[model samples]
Target: MSTLSDYLNEHLPDGWQKPQLVEALSGTLDRATVYRYLAGSHPRSPAESVLEAFAKVLPGVTVVELRAAANLSAGAEEPWVPPVEANRLSHAQRRALESFIKATVGPIDDGDEPNHRQPSVDLQPAAPALTEQERAEVESYVQRLYASGRKDLADRVASSLVNNPSIEPATRPADA
Candidate 1:
């Protein structure tokens, strides 16, 4: 596999040097940084913005190719598999999602008097309780979370469902 340094040396256009390249990169990176990149000794992965700049400056060399040369990806084509039924969010996730929605969408009010708003006159109906199948799906998601090394999140999710009086506990799979 070609390293980033090798790619740079091979592809840099004629008459271009480290200083010129640095200047072309809009001074975000210094000449020494360019040297380190050419030396293959930069401490961190090149930022995407830097890669984009390089793509603009270097003719015939693309960011994707540069990323591949940097060992960022295998550059293989793969079939996409839709995710296992979308994972059900825990109560905490639900709260976070609701907060995010509210932050982005702001409060919704039907054109009624703001000061006279009534709690009984909600425009949208309340969400229905989860069905048994949905509960099973949530349990599956929790199990997957634990398996994927997110035990803390999984524990919180399970605990939330267990502690909630409104939600019935999910039935566990026999194999679990």
Candidate 2:
């Protein structure tokens, strides 16, 4: 997926400053508006309407499509430019997006081998290890998730650990 920065830099017309663009959208919108808009806050109501003005300023297409595309692509390490919208996605396009995000942000070494996996995010060096109290708090949170039958969130947590670079992975040899 094109980084949000790329979209802002390339799509916004030349000679118009980002602040100017923000001003055009809403006179009261501040610097943070430009920052968050480019940083990829998904559209909410009036902001959604403003995207149309953006398309006009940029020219040619409907803003809803642009916003939807950006919404799906936000925060991804790669550019996932779908030539068509969700409704128009072919089986192939669907598979590609799923594969892309799963590979980029989902679990590591999930059996698609031969391509070395580098973490999309480089986390800061670890701080001191978790305190016993911190561990207890985390354990309680996990237990609460399980007790509430939020298995999907539990699965996401497990996947995050599997992909995390902070913890060295435990390895086991294959057995006959």
Best by lDDT: 1
Query: Any idea what lDDT model 1 has?
Result: 0.54
User: What does candidate 1's lDDT look like per residue over 50-140, in tens digits?
Assistant: 6666778888877766655554431222333435543566665444434422332222322232212222212231222344445555666
lDDT of 1 at 114: 24
Model 2, which residues run further than 4 Å from truth?
Answer: 1-5, 28-31, 41-47, 71-176
Scored by CA lDDT, what does every candidate get? 0.54, 0.44
Q: In model 1, what are the clashing residue pairs, if there are any?
A: none
* lDDT (10s digit) by residue, model 2, range 1-176: 23333455556666877776777666544567566766555233224445545656565444543443333212322345745446675565355435433444322222322212222233222122333333333334444445557666544533433433555422222320
lDDT of 2 at 135: 34
* TM-score for each of the candidates: 0.42, 0.31
Q: What number of backbone clashes does candidate 2 have, counting pairs of residues 3 or more apart or in separate chains?
A: 4
* Span of ten consecutive residues with least summed lDDT in model 2: 106-115
